[model samples]
Target: MNEEDLSVLDTVDILDSPLDAIELSEPDSATSPPDPEEMLLLLEHPESTQRIVAARAFCELKDERAIPHLINLLQDVCPLTRVSAAYALGRNPSPVALAPLISLLQQDWNGYVRKGVVWALGNSQDTLALKPLIKALKTDISAVRLWSASSIVQIAQLEYESVVSAIPPLIEALRRDAIAPVRSNCAWAVGQLCRELPLNVVYATAIDALIEALAEDQDLGVKEDAKLALLRVGDPRGLKMIEELEQEGWI
Candidate 1:
């Protein structure tokens, strides 16, 4: 299976199963948590691979109690360790870790770290992270921006109100941002926001942005995104602008 499939496998049967026997020789109930030392051993191994292995171990175990220690590893010099820590902590999201993860989402520059943060945010399903994730949707990197958009869609589906407010910012970004990746996120976010709050006011506001984007935006991705957003709003002016761009061979 793929890496994603493996992560799924790592997560399977965690919550429902009896926890691993503390001593492995004696038996405890399914809910009996694993020994902290055992988890520490994995993380403290000399090799970075071993640390990643340990991180995955915690993730598969689905122990919400281990979030803090895993988060501390986010700054590890090893990229694999840092990303693994993020994945592990995300899978085991707890109240204590929520704020820290949101901050990490805002500050992390590493693409893999950002990817892990977005995935964790989706797993946590925290409405509080909506604004930060929306901000991340403006990241210059395509991978980071796309993952942020995907996270917003997931969060919006689960809890719409907190994320619904993201629409106006997204529309504004789509209209004016020079970065193609960020503009694409703005377009996708606009679609997701529309699902939650289909206010005519929003469509009207977004139509103007899309019209300007189609007329003046230089990037193909942003221009195409503007076209798609315009189609959604049924803006005749946007359609005319798109046709003009096509005629000019700019699209």
Candidate 2:
């Protein structure tokens, strides 16, 4: 056969070859968890995959001793290792991990890494993360902003006070974020905050912003989310607007 024809035949043979059958082993429930020294050694392994596996194992073990090691991995050469470290930190909550996670959220070059940091903050449920998450709304990256908004919502659900400082930025995000989903999520976050805050407390500006979004935002999804937010905040103007939309069949 000519070289080209032989190459094609070789390719077909490789494609048709049977895959290796991998054996799976179940963990022994009776076996003891890995000692701290063993876990630390794994975290320092030359292979990134081994380090990641160790981080996940720490998560499953919920060992607080792994917090510092995981935080160190947040700056690992591999982004995947950093992501895994963030995930492990989130799964295993520690007050000590809070500052490191926040720092990573702000400084991580990778958006996915920042995303993982956001999840870790949300999982921490520490009200201390509230302002940083609010600031995250202004992030140019949509995914980070989206998760930041979600983390805000999660934190607010636990502590109403967490949303108090978040209001102005959230309103701004709803009014002006370039991405429709970020704007939509901001509207949802604002609505959630308003619902928890006292009715007598004046969030007149926020109410007005949502009203404007409902009336004039370019995106239909933002408008709808704004309407829902306003309704959630129990704004009379929002109720009126929804009624009008329903009557006009524009809802």
Candidate 3:
């Protein structure tokens, strides 16, 4: 529903209306957003567009009563509807929605829908999300991987055991993913998880990966994110390496 989700125009262009039929209008100063109760009714509208609008409205309104309706829209034939429902579920983040979201993430052919589903799972913060999200980070498209990295960090908040399990894949992706945004996200995830990890082999390994990225990554954005990770963790070893690299004008 934010900048990350599909734009309002992109979602509304479901049927590919002719350009001539489109018109821009000025906002009425007194007009208000649709009533939540009315919008909820549109969740079951026969027209896919209305369903999409209603589902998207919940991303901002976030009524829990919309939960089952949003879940039902996950199976709608329209991908836009499905994806919008996915984003709405992310905003609501009802526990019951997680399983259905995971199923859609696993089987939906549309990348956008999968992306929204992963975002929703992250919001769930359930340990159940860890494995599927890790798989998505490793194997899904870059956009999904980017969000998966972020979602992994969100779930990392809940448990130490899960943090231990989550760090390795994040480190792996940090060093290997071709996409800079994904790498940057993994760097941020690694830093956040390291903040919670007790001193251990896994913590050292994550710090090492961040330092390695700072020294060797081809992209400046990835390197900056890694540098920020190192700075945030404040590990003396990482700090010393950063200082030496700065003195040598390598940072």
Which candidate wins on lDDT?
3
Candidate lDDT values, in order: 0.64, 0.74, 0.84
lDDT of 2 by residue, 1-251 (tens): 23233233223123111101100123458997656678778988999989977875665567777888898999898877787788778778789989999998887776666767887898888888887888777853676787688788777667656656777788888888877877888888878777777664436666777888887789999988988888777878778878987798776
* Candidate with better TM-score, 2 vs 3: 3
Per residue, candidate 3 scores C-alpha lDDT tens digits across 52-152 of: 88987777676899999999999999988898888888878888998999999999877777878888899887889989999999988777788899899
Where does candidate 1 stray beyond 4 Å? 1-41, 44-46, 56-69, 75-77, 106-111, 137-146, 156-161, 229-251
The list of candidate 2 runs beyond 4 A from truth reads 1-41, 57-61, 156-161, 231-235
- Cα deviation of 186, candidate 2, in Å: 0.6
Candidate 1, residues 125-158, lDDT tens digits: the string is 7787777777776643445555666677677666
RMSD in angstroms, all models?
10.7, 10.8, 6.9
Candidate 1: the clashing residue pairs are: 18-30, 19-30
**By descending lDDT, how would the candidates be arranged?**
3, 2, 1
Worst-scoring 10-residue span by lDDT in model 2:
15-24
